[model samples]
Target: MYPLLEVHLDIIGENASKVLRLCEGKGIDVVGVTKGCSAFPEVAFVLLEAGIKILGDSRLDNIKKLRRAGVACPLMLLRIPMLSEIRELVELADMALVSEISVVKAINEEARRLGKFFKVILMIDMGDLREGIWPINLLSYLDSIRSLNYVELLGIGANFGCFGGVLPTPESVSMLINYASLAREYTLSDIPIVSVGGTVALQLLEEEK
Candidate 1:
């Protein structure tokens, strides 16, 4: 027999609920990431039942699975999108993490062609050396995005403890907050969400820093 991996759905649901409660108390919304489970509908349903209003996955195929399974909540594409996949991405995902202006333009074009509006989280690289653009270029990206009709700048996000092993510190978290503030000032939009990547960020909340 192949090595079997077992999941206790009850335990997972309990944990997710606990985390959701914690985050909600802190005025934070959690995006239940389904990538770890390959976006399996069973697990996705568990998360949804536990009050996860949004689901995130790195693969478009996974998003498709959730959609086909009748998961109706907003779906977020966690990975920076490929230009070639922009059309389907615009069709499938409600929001995405984007770093490159070219990909954003492609998404805008597709959304316009389909007569659909798309949402995106502009990613900033706060020394994580990951998928986000550097902070200095933020204004330029915002400028370009502001001109797009179909693409809406949903918020700003940053990755940590991934490629560069940069752990999330209070300073780093504050920097992300500052960027969100700057973006709002420049775009004159609310820019409500400020997302932080990596499970390690949970520590900051725990420490209440």
Candidate 2:
């Protein structure tokens, strides 16, 4: 047991609260991302107690773990899901980030089978080239998925600094905001979660401009 890891739950809770308060005053809602910590239950619980509205993880198994521990906030799948795991994704996550039309269709079918309507954020690739549809293809792709009754289009988002190392700037985030507007225009409704970030996007918030 010499290599055993140690965690201070109370300290984590305090730190999370301070960060959440800072983000909150600036009108930002924080999602406690548990992937880096491998979704440790104690740490995740501390984040929950610190008031994150959503718990986000890249793996379905991690989200499942959080749910089994009775974490009550809405759970979000940070990574785009695979077609094979649509059923699990539907069962476990309240919302997911998605790009491919085929995967979206699978999720729709799975949601219909499960008698649940799942929420989704369409990811736009603003040069990071990781997991989003290209901006030019966004509107048309939205049109294709607009009729998906079992899937509620929650909002739009983008990923940067993950693969391509493209840093998020005010200009790039503005582009994401514009895409969200375009999505609303197509649907003629208010988009709920314009999630335009990952961990790196935090830099945008910390900046005074």
Where is the poorest 10-residue window by lDDT in model 2?
Answer: 200-209
As for candidate 1, its clashing pairs are none
My TM-score estimates for the predictions, one after another, are: 0.97, 0.95
Residue 184, candidate 1: Cα error in Å is 0.4
Per-residue lDDT of candidate 1, residues 1-209 (tens digit):
89999988899899999889878888999999999999989999999999999999999999999999999999999989888899889888899999999999999999999999999999999887988998889999999999999999999999888899998899888989999999999999998999988567888788887
The lDDT for every candidate, in the order shown, is 0.92, 0.86
- Summarize candidate 2's per-residue lDDT along 80-101 as a digit string, tens digits: 9988888899998898999989
Tell me, by lDDT, which candidate is best: 1
Write down the RMSD of candidate 2 (Cα, Å): 1.3
